[model samples]
Target: MALMITDECINCDVCEPECPNDAISQGAEIYVIDPNKCTECVGHYDTPQCVEVCPVDCIPKDPDHAETQDQLRAKYEKLVAAKG
Candidate 1:
């Protein structure tokens, strides 16, 4: 499943650089995760890096964009291919 940055985010700016997929970005207020680009580090690491580094623990799975591990891996592969 894709992860989301909640309103509880303190905008510490730690999560953005930690995202391997480049899915996190500054929004009007807090950071936002682009579900289309989010693979939760499926291809890069065992755990989502952004969640690991976030100080507030505000990042959580986005139920609205629920996806299986296979789907996330597929998305990660697609993203990698697109970068080439």
Candidate 2:
């Protein structure tokens, strides 16, 4: 599933750089995760880096954007290809 930044986010800016997919962004108050770009770090890391680094544990799975591991891998490949 794609990860989401909840209202509990502290906006400490720690999670943004930790995201391999560049999915996290600073919002008006808290950081936000772009579900389209988030793969839960599937192809880049064994675990979600943002979730691992978030001090408040605000990063959680987005039920609305849930996907299988294979789906996440495909999304990652597409993102990589688009950047090339």
Model 1 alpha-carbon drift over 4 Å, by segment: none
Residue pairs of candidate 2 with colliding backbone atoms? none
Query: For candidate 2, what is the lDDT?
Result: 0.91
How far does residue 5 in candidate 2 sit from its true spot (Å)?
A: 0.5
Q: Top model by TM-score, which number?
A: 1
Over 29-83, each residue of candidate 2 has an lDDT whose tens digit, in order, gives: 8899999999999889999999898888988899999899999999999999999
Give the Cα-based TM-score of candidate 2 against the true structure: 0.97
What TM-score would each prediction reach against the true structure?
A: 0.98, 0.97
Q: What's model 1's lDDT at 31?
A: 95
Error of 1 at 65 (Å): 0.6
